[model samples]
Target chain A: MRSRALALPMAAVLALSACTGALSDTGSLLGRDTLRIGVKADQPGLGLRGPSGEFTGFDVDVALDIAERLGVEPADVEFVEVTSAEREEALREGRVDMVVATYSITPARKTEVTFAGPYYVAHQDILVRADERSIDDVRDLAGRRLCQGEGSNSATRVIGERGVAARLIEAPTYSECVTMLEEGEVDAVSTDDLILAGFLLRSRDAFRIVNAPFTDEKYGVGVAEGDLSGCEAVNRAITDMYQDGTAEALLRMWFGDTGLDLVTSVPQFEGCS
Target chain B: MTAEAPPRPDRPTARSRAAERARRAAGRTTVRVWTLTAACLVGIAVLFAVTTGAIAQARDGFQVIGHGAGPKVAATADLYFALSDMDAQVANVLLMGDEHDLGAGREEALRRYEQRRDDADSALLHAAQLAEGDDAEQENVRAVLDGLGDYEQLVAEARLLNDEAGGGAGQPPAAVVDRYREATDLMRLELLPKAYNLTLESGATVRATYEDRRSATRLGPVWVALSGAAAAGALIALQLYLSARFRRRYNPALVVATAGVVGLVGLATLMLDDQAQQLRTAKEDGLDSVLALSRARAISTNMNADQSRWLLDPERADTYAQGFLEDAQTVLYVEDAAGEVPGDLAGYGAEVDDAVTERGGYRGRMLGFLGEEVRDAPLAGQAAAQQEVLRAYDGFLRADRDMRLIAESGREREAVSAHMGGAGSVEDAFDRYEEALIELTDLHRDTFDEAVRAGDDGAAGWDVLLPAACLAFAVLVLAGVRPRLAEYR
Candidate 1:
């Protein structure tokens, strides 16, 4: 009797243990459906929203293509607006399926999420007023003020470097930084050259970006870590895009004549740290 | 021993000894049952707590994933975009310095150059505001800005001299242009890298954030499984003790306790499985999609901005425009294509067609503007044509209203036509392309936003559900164990 009584619960516990294996087959949890992404709203030629409220830019086009390859229809994929500080948390907590808002790949970020493909390469630079005097080299503005977007790496680089002592002003976006410069609230703005070019184009007569790159930045797509299959898939898509003419066509469509040497060759996976 | 046996004849020793043994066994059974019950209850409670915690964490992780990806992505995107623009501006200023005449056109170029500089200044300020890194980058940018101001003053003086010479019709004053070129070259080669370094540093931080999120997502399920296993183990032990104590095969309370443990474990396992899957999908599919989009966009934007800046400098405008096109075609197009054409290849094809048409029209305008000068020396003509092309392009670009109209209508063909019409002057083409590119960028932004919203919707409510489930499972397990304890009493 004692053995029989023990047997029942023991069997049940074993049965429950067996069910644990069911947890291992996690495939069904991700239903077959479209994934939504969030990107920048105002970046020119990259992720700008049209007056008709249609999303179209180099980034948007690439993201759509990725969705289609994932079996998501064009109408199925949605978009959300996100700023600089919000991208990582969003991806970690599952707010968005993906983020294509000019994210870069780096060793530090590899700790949190998986990344795939350097779809585009960029660098940082400085912009100054066309007629401004007394500022030319990085060392020339030692005691002056500089503007950058809040939560931007540019701000940290500027603030962290040795032998430089400039007041830092923060803004939410590159455009706002331009406004600050226009309003004389800061001395200089540091960010990616492409964005500054947009500002210069818009301002027409108010600013010019210094024609030298301060750093190399390669933009990558971010996903939750250990999603090797998804990472591989995205990597493949990007690689395919590079080989085909689609990337070029999109580039021409968005950036009429910006001089960026987009690399056509596939990028090798330098394992993420 | 024989004497003792004789004495025990009246005592019934064997039967008494057997009975005492039975009673002691029964007492031991009772104690074991009570102890087992208590252990089971405690195990169940811990399991519940752990499961609940895991669920809660999973949910929180999901929310963080869903909500946090945007800003970091945006910051990096903006940084790249700004840097690309600054590079173009620097290049343009240098090219402008090569011109012998600082006439109205040259002055206009200078003004545009100044504006680009201003924009760069603003971008730095914006970067600083974000506080992503240390303070040194801000200082470096400031120093560069200051140096650029000094250079600008020198360039302005040179411009004055050239302008004066142009008005007087004497030997062209090339000295000022030379000085301006020298200053620009110095800044471009030296100070610019400081800013680039800053961007690189920030990129590191953004990448780190991505990694942190990835690990958290992956670890969530393991926690749940462990907790569930622990709970199940305790319940089984309790059931064994209860069975021994009562000599009964069926213990309803023990059975209930076992069932509750199973249920809790099962629920936790399922929830964990689901959460893991979602996180995996996000990691695998989502990150790269975002990166590719951003890279393509950044490159494209850089190309557009550079093209426009080239138009501002007529003398070397064609060279710059050609350079811009080459870069765009190579980086933005072929690289982004990867391999097979996307489903929406038509849109890309249309865009390419429009670009080609625009380029052709720009070439024709350059030829027209150059007239005889272009014919005298083909190389000179090419140079002259490039300058003329740029001017026509600028004119086209500046006509924002027409470009906006074409963009609003989604009439790629019409837009191309309008762009060609405006390409009679470099200035014209510049205006049209600028408007067109801006419109295209806007469209992409909307598309990205929609994708984000969909992702968010799919992942919602996990945070609250996880903790609640854990807590409930614990309560059920404890309740089931309580009846077994009462039976012991």
Candidate 2:
């Protein structure tokens, strides 16, 4: 009789464990028919949320492909605008199912949320005015004004880690940084090469990106913390996107005209752990 | 006397001594009379100078403050309104999409936009002229003009894209929307704020000048009265001395001289007092109301643009709605005591409607331009005109709510149509409101013009009359004492 009672308790414990396993960090996302993907709204060719309530860009297309593989239609996907600072918060609050914005994967961020794949690796570069001849490299930014977009560590990385000693000027976004550069308010803007390339498409004669590369910014798909299934799903979808040649096509469509070397092969995925 | 005259030495005589004493007395009397006459003439001269100077100052104030910066500042107000309307027309044109005949249509919208642009340019020119001496203001004007150029380019690009997309009966494609967003953002962020700053700087100047000029005008009467009293007093004193010394009840010339001095001084005092009153009317009843109404018109125009923006872009509808509510609050804020007021048009509409329905009449719970207009109606019929404005404004609020409701219920085209179309639309209601406001503004403007004209008239002829009166007063003073002095001779 004691064995019988113990077996019943053991069965209940096993059932509860199974239930807990099923309800994961991404339970809300995978179970839902619609996927809400966070994206940048102002970035011209990366993930610009256009005026007619539609999203277009490399990040946007990548997000849609991942959503499609996860059994969500393009029409069922909703694009939520997120800044670099709010990506983690948006995932934590379930405001977005996944963030496919230009979110870079790092050890510090990995502790907060699970990153799926590098998807694309972009190097940090400097953008200066067309007439600028003094600044050709990251090291040359010493004592010159550099734009620091809000919630971005690019300017600080150049000034702090690289020991550039550049005077940091602040703006809310990369778009404003470009405006400031055009207005001669700032000497240079440093960020991911892809973002600069997007802006360079508009006014090639006004601004030129300095080809000097510094830091490697591994762009990742962010899901909620401990959402191992969601992370694996995104990584698999990203691999398919590359294998099916959709990645190269989307990159060509958005950033082909810009003279940046396009990397089309499947990027090494960050571990779902 | 006979004994005195009997034996007179050749050296001295009593009659000769008496004659010498009489001659000395007559000389002293003549000198005293002349001295009093000169004092009276000096008093009259002071009165003339003070009166004429005050009048001249009043006339100068009217020319400089009333006609100079006053109209220029008013032009700035027009610029603010025109900038807002231009943006509104842009939104309306986009809302028309591929269809050209929707509501007032794209062509009509474009025509209005062009007209507003021209108006804006004209205003900028005026602002530039007004800002000629101020380097900082001149820089601001240049910046605004540059910003406007950029804004227009963006708008033109948006229109071209919209036409190319040919999206039927709704919002154009994403590209067009993005371009339009960029244009509107430029207008709102850079252009509108800078324009408003120009207005504020110019408005402050107007207010400061009004205060200075008004104070000068107000104190004019007191100064004139004091000098006039001195002149009249001196004249009366001279007349009394002449009458008593000459052993006559009155000297006709001196009496006439005293009357003339009192009459002229009284006339000068009355003229100054009336001019002061007119200036006060101009500032308090006119310019203040005109400024408030101008701000109201500009804000309402922006609010209407927000409505069109809400319809044009569904993605940012809530943002535009929030902006509309904020601007609406600025135009007419109703105070809520319970702290339960929601920060949305729904809640605000309820509050305003409830206030309007209150039986005891407007309990002064309302604030903002509208409230100020009603509370401070200085002229006759102004209060009634303000009431009509309030009524028309209520109609506009209702129409806006209805348009939003239709849009929310998935009838966006109907909503857009109602916004841009004929009678009973939001446009119609807004037009009514604007008309009422314009009527009230005209009343104030008319008062200002009248005050300026009357103020000029009050000081008229005083320049020549002052010197002429002074000269005549001097002549009359000489004439009044001439006979008395001749007695001593």
Best candidate, lDDT-wise? 2
Clash statistics: count for each candidate: 237, 0
Query: Candidate 2: where are CA atoms >4 Å away?
Result: A1-273, B1-17, B337-342, B359-364, B376-378
Docking class of 1: incorrect
Candidate 2 per-residue lDDT, tens place, B362-426, comes to 45366566765676666889878887888888888899999989888998778888887888999
Worst 10 residues of 2 chain A by lDDT: A1-10
B56-116: candidate 1 lDDT, tens digit per residue: 5555555544455333444444444454544444433333333423222445545555665
CA RMSD of all predictions: 23.1, 27.5
Positional deviation of residue A130's Cα in model 1 after best superposition, in angstroms:
39
Error in Å for residue A91 of model 1: 33
Residue B454, model 2: lDDT of 89
The two-chain DockQ for each candidate, comma-separated, is 0.02, 0.01
Highest TM-score against the true fold, candidate: 2
| Candidate 2 structure, TM-score to reference | 0.62
- lDDT (Cα atoms) of all candidates against the true structure: 0.52, 0.78
